[model samples]
Target: MLAFERLGIRFGGNQAVQDVTGSLTPGKITAIIGPNGAGKTTFFNMLSGFYKPTSGVITLSGQPISGRPTHEVVARGVARTFQTTTLYKNLSALENAVLGHRVRTKAGLLDALLRSGRERHDESESLKAAHHALERVGLERKAHVTASLLSQEEQKRVSIASALATQPSILLLDEPAGGLNPEETARLMDLIRQLVGAGLTVALIEHKMNLVMGLADQVMVLHHGQLIAQGPPAEVSRNPAVITAYLGSHGGGGQHGQSAPAGGASV
Candidate 1:
């Protein structure tokens, strides 16, 4: 449901992403993998409207979405969670999740001041949605707790719930497993699989190779701001370029046609 065509981004004279092209279909997860400084996050920023692309087009379901304001992108059925967990520390978990719903309304000052039945109904619905989102991420019991009281993994789940609360058609996740333990990472992968199975399009930039290989339906490898390979995990793992760039130093052993387990592990 998300497609990029000849995408390029530059900062002054330096290009961080160049001629990138890919497609992520609905009900599927696409993983973007690359070594450090490969412009993976830069591509995500451009896609999320955080940075306008220097050249190219980003389309969602056939409509161009690139260069739109960030809020406008959210309004157009796109929502993303950052690599860092960004919850209001003092706020209750429920309150933090409900913030995602604020972008879904069309209320004005008068509506807030008057507190009409419509506003009340919307508010109630927002709470219900937020609660459901929290439950989806397995954080329902912590709804009334302060965001700061949770652990790092819990905070990441809260971030995902907040994004889901926005009801976006496409969810872009940046390194959702960055700081989690192995067990937590496995659970997160299961959650991601469940999300895509339920009809949401997910595109993620992740370094946790185990989760990516196990959960991603398609893999796109970027190196030096260009796509070096794109294919199934089995094929991408065996790709000469991908091995040399990210895996060669870590037990790749110059074997290009054998299965390689992710997460710096061997199969």
Candidate 2:
């Protein structure tokens, strides 16, 4: 599990994130929701080492990992997918997934140039892992398809599969369902649940209220770079600050009313 305390970062005079503190419980989905500029992705960037915190402590299990280089952070069992799908558009899905192994490979450019045995071995391992990753996302049948030719939903899965090929225990997703329709969203939900069911810990920043409310084991709310509320869906939905800041008037207000704010994802 990962835990942090009093975490914060700054850009000139802007406090992009401030005094945010939380943990990703093992085998559970933690959904982060808030209005724009709430620092949700900033929080993720800090945790994943894309950005280093100006203050606070981050520990995986019981060791410090804050500010570590991204490859080092990833080597420590954390990996992430971007809000946008970041596959190699010109490559086959399998080849794109194989790129995840680059961070973990020990063979260097010289070894590759010399055609060393280590390079071949690492490549074989990467290929095997990539195949397994595509299988995990149910893209084994389309492994050879060009990334640009795949559907948007498939591209999303391929992005996820690339992360899985890195073999991370903690997965940080930034809007995995951003553009999908209801049915596609539902299927994405099932895939998320399946990942958790198989023992991956998940944390995500998403604007889709229904996805967060229905799928998150715990929901954390942020506004203006600070955490305002965090708890189970119902409890967070009922918090007055959450309602006033991001949830709007009817967020979990009654049995018949929708808990979402105006414009399902604008919040």
Candidate 3:
């Protein structure tokens, strides 16, 4: 399990996340939901090692990992996707995915310069891994395509392929359904479920309550950097504090087709 103990972060005098504690079980999908400025992405940043928490500890299967560098975290079996797609636009999808295996490669600069046997071996392994990752995300056919030329949904899948190439135990996704149409969103949802079914732990920060309610095994509600409620979706959805914090007067009722509020905090 991935666990956070009283995790908190402060930006100057402003507290972005405070005393937030939670555990994400392996092989399950956990959804993080909240309104603008609710610190949803801030929490994700800390988990992915992009931000070092000002206080508290984070542990994965009993090993402390808080404040580790991002690459180190990836090496430790955690990989993530951002709200904004991060890809090498000029690179082919397969090449971009191959880059994700950098942390696991042992070939040195000297090996590359000399074109040694080890370099060749590692390169071959990386290519195979990249192809498998793309296949997992249903993007194998687009492997040779330039990232910039793919549709938004395809770009998102490429990003996911890159993360999968790392062979992570935990996958953190931020706003994956952000700009997707309903059909695309449904496909993405099915993909996520398939991943979880294949024994991966997924934690997503999503604005779409419909996706959250339908897909998550556990739901965590954040409000102004604090965890206001957490439980199964049915339970969290009915919590009055959670409703006031983000669900609004609809009480999460009409959230099926609605988007999140404008200018929501990113991190």
Candidate 4:
């Protein structure tokens, strides 16, 4: 599990995130939704160690993880995907996914240069894991495809597959549905649900209200860089402050409620 207490960050005089508190538990999905500039990504950056917090602490299980370097955080069972799908454009899908296993690799550069048994064995395992990750995202059949040749949705799923290959305990996804169409977003939602069913903890920052309300086990709404409401999807959808700040722009709670169909509703 991952927990944060009074977590915040500042850039010079700008308080991008302020005193937000929450937790993500095993086999559950936590959706963070907000308008533009709500500091959702800032919270994720701090949690994933891309940015050191200006206040408060983040912990995984019972130990502090805040302020650690990004690689250190990944090494400690936390991995994330960026809002932008990051991939080696020229690399095969399998190759890009294999990079995720670097955090778990034990073979040294020297071993690779010498083609030692250890390097060969490590590579075999990494490739196997990469294939498994690709399968999870339904991309195994395209493992040899170049990253640049994939469609937009495929690219996003590949980005997720690469992160999943890291064998992380907690996965932070920044805007996983940012640009996908309705059908693509539906597929992505099902993929995310499968991940939770497989016992991985997921926290995602998404502007797609429907996904948040339908897929998330818990929901957190952010505004002006702070949490205004957080709870189960139905409760959050009805919060007066949440409506005033964000959801009201879409509709005041009926279609955005937890019972709403995932494929319907654009806000």
Candidate 5:
């Protein structure tokens, strides 16, 4: 479980994120939705330790984790995948995932140089972990392939597999469906559901309203750096504030260039 209480962040004189508060339950998917510049990414960066929040606290499993270093936060059972794919083009998919397990390796410098018993054991364990992570993401067949040679969708999966290789209790995904086709998006939804079914908590920020509506158990809407709405999909869809926030910017009463079914409800 996680909680953000009255979270606030300012970039110079601009208050990018203003007093936002929410919580994420274990074994559930929570979606943070809003138009561009809603401060969703800023909230994520603060939670992930990329930026220290100007105010409030972020607690993971009841312990405050605000202002911790990114690496330290990751070691504390949190992992993240960016909007854009981040992988080693020269490395094989398996190698990239193995790198995620780097923090867990016990092989010392001398052991690595000499290929000692400990080094060999660590290597074998890391390999098995990497393979297992890839398998979880349906990328096992691409394990030995070079990352640069894979398609965009495949590359995205590899990025997720790498994050999973870290064995996180909570995963934060930014725009997982950003560039995927319909089929790919469906597959991604299935993967996310599977992860939640397996008891992993997921906090996702997605522009793809369809995916969010179909997958999120709880939806939180942010507008102008503030919490505009928070509830189940059905209630959120009927909210006037949400409609205005989505539709007002565009010419129509509640139509933002595209129609996003209310509440991140099922598509």
Candidate 6:
């Protein structure tokens, strides 16, 4: 399990995340939901090693990994995708996927310069892994296509494929459904479930209540950098604190200027 205890971070005088604690169980999907500025992304950044928490501890299978470098985190079975697609537009999908295997590569500068047997073996392994990742996402047919030519949904899949290539036990996805149409979103949802079924732990930060409610095994609600509610989807949706946080005093009413879906009180 990936666990957080009082995990928090401060930027200068601003406390971006504070006193948040949670655990992502293995082989399950955990969704983090909150309004803008609620510090959901901040919390994710801390987990991915983009930012170090000012106070708290993070552990993977009981081993502390709070302030480690990003590469180290990846090496320790944690890999993540961003809110925005981060692929090289000019690169083929296969090439982009191969980059994710960097942490597993053992070839040194000498191996590269001399074209040693180890370098060739690593290259062959990376190519095989990349193709497998693309196949996992149903994108193996598009391996040779440049990223820029793919549709938004396809690009998102490529990003996911890249992360999968890293062979992580824990996957962190930031807004994986951000710009997809309903059909695409549904497909992505199925893909997430399949990954969890295969024993990969998934922790996602999402604003779409429908996806969170439908896909998550557990839901965590954040407000103003603090954890406001956590439980199974049905229970968390009915929590008065969660309702108030999302809809303000108009709890059962409209979205209250929030971009969340209408009747999002159901979480």
Top TM-score: which candidate number?
A: 6
How well is each residue in 54-170 modelled by candidate 1, as lDDT tens digits?
899999889999999998888787889998888999998899999988788776678889998778877888899899999989999999999999988889999999989988889
Whole-model lDDT per candidate = 0.86, 0.88, 0.89, 0.87, 0.86, 0.89
CA RMSD for every model? 3.5, 3.6, 4.0, 3.8, 2.6, 1.9
Error of 2 at 70 (Å): 0.7
lDDT of 3 by residue, 1-267 (tens): 889999999999999999999899899999998877889899999999999999999998899999999998999999999999999999999999999987778899999999999999999999999999999999999999999999999999999999999999999999999899889999999999999999999999997777887889998888889999999988887777775665356655433333333232222
Candidate 6 at residue 65, lDDT?
Answer: 96
Tell me which of candidates 1 and 4 scores higher on lDDT: 4
Residue 142, candidate 2: how far off, in angstroms? 0.4
Clashing pairs in 5: 213-264, 233-263
**What clash pairs does model 1 have?**
none
Query: Which residue pairs clash within candidate 2?
Result: none
Clashing residue pair totals per candidate (backbone < 3 A)? 0, 0, 0, 0, 2, 0
Runs in model 4 deviating more than 4 A are 247-267
TM-score of each: 0.91, 0.93, 0.92, 0.92, 0.91, 0.95
- Candidate 4 per-residue lDDT over residues 169-196, each given as its tens digit: 8899999998998899999999999998
Candidate 5 lDDT over 187-259, as tens digits, reads 9999999988887999999877778778899889988899999887667767788877777755365543545
